[model samples]
Target: MTEQLPDTISRLYADPGEYVDSDHPAVEAFARAAVPSDASARDKARRLYTAVRDGIRYNPYVSMRSPESYRASSVLAAGNGYCVGKAALYAAACRVHGIPARVGFADVRNHLTTEKLRQSMGSDLFTWHGFTEVFVDGAWRKATPTFNDTLCAKLGVKPLDFDGHADALLHPFDGEGRAYMQYVNDHGSYHDVPAKFLMREMAREYANMQGEDLAGRDMEREATEQ
Candidate 1:
């Protein structure tokens, strides 16, 4: 039997913040469009998961220097973002509809990276890979909406799907059944994205890869530059 969650636990997941701005118009609109007013909690969770998974383009090269980039409303307005930004948007969207959600982070080794991005990062190790942990059906289910369907098609990887009752995590193997991403370190979960903590780790881990001047560097350019 599923254990009952206390009110405090639910509140923790629904709490809003600078990063998880559930009250923002953008987030509210996002939630409403994804989830129908008459839908059940499970159906709402599923729709929201799919909306976030495919709606926003996944570009791992967004700037981490600005705090605005990490905000859920900002990510929604931009229409594209990295894993962390997308995760924040998903969590915020969930919270806006009174569904409990939180952000989760871990370091991963991506085995299938584009040539440009792989070279730019100088390593396969990706720090602070983000996903959403949504409380649904008396439990928390994880989903990674980092890779959009278009990108998945391009990369030949199967798109991740969420059903609300199951964990929608990254596939251990790709479409060809080859090894994909591997999680190395889990930084646990939070109600909001910890920008300073994440940025510090990114700056430290990707300093050389990001170039000498991380503050002024445009990460998108680095990912695109041959």
Candidate 2:
């Protein structure tokens, strides 16, 4: 299929049907959260980000790799989730304000250390990890704020700000660290590395991340710790 804007945006903004504007109190509060009258696109994106990063902490009480029945209100009430829930909450909030945002993912190395596993476990690092992308200026930029201290400390990599226009700091590993190439709907064709579709594939493929947390998963944990 040829790349078309409306069709592409339609798929990109497809509702998860899990959360909506009035389903929960938290969602309502977030909807009411101030969107400054003078805000620009970046300001709007940042506001949505602050809501999740500061409002919620990262905890996997819900199905870690799968989304629960979290409406924006439920997430606000609970104030926590792994990645998907928080990202869903953020995306929902941004959408309500008429901002164009969608979920995205990457395999960040050294993401966390689990209690049952002290060593590098591959699949645990890539499960349903979600981030948001907002339309700005003439293009879309990425943002990741759901990852918090616990997960960052466990993985030993610095979590970054969701500016909606900066490169991801949670690199798999390099001098300054590098990013996992996005991998969704890949047909072994010429790829652009950051297409939004990769988020879907990333959520599905690495859902069972377990064991050695392969070099592909988080080589930094292995090289730095050992």
For residues 1-226, could you state the per-residue lDDT of candidate 1 as single tens digits? Answer: 4756799988878878789999898789889988779998888888887898789888666777667778888888888888999899889988987889999998888987777677678898888899999888888888998888877877778789888888887888888988888889998999889998777778787776555433434333443442
What alpha-carbon RMSD in Å does predicted model 2 have with respect to the real structure? Answer: 8.0
lDDT of 2 by residue, 1-226 (tens): 1233475564445333344333345564575574674687677777768767666776543433232423455566776665555666776666666665565654443333453333322344453356666665546666666666445554555655666556442444423454432333212211111223444454455444422233233323433454
Worst lDDT 10-window in candidate 2: 186-195
Error of 2 at 3 (Å): 12
Model 1: lowest-lDDT 10 consecutive positions: 212-221
lDDT of each: 0.82, 0.51
After TM-score superposition, the amount by which residue 120's alpha carbon in candidate 2 deviates from its true location, in angstroms, is 11
TM-score on alpha carbons, each prediction: 0.91, 0.60
Query: Could you tell me how far off, in angstroms, the CA of residue 13 lies in candidate 2 after the best superposition?
Result: 3.0
lDDT for model 1 comes to 0.82
What is the model-wide C-alpha lDDT for candidate 2? 0.51
- Name the TM-score of candidate 2: 0.60
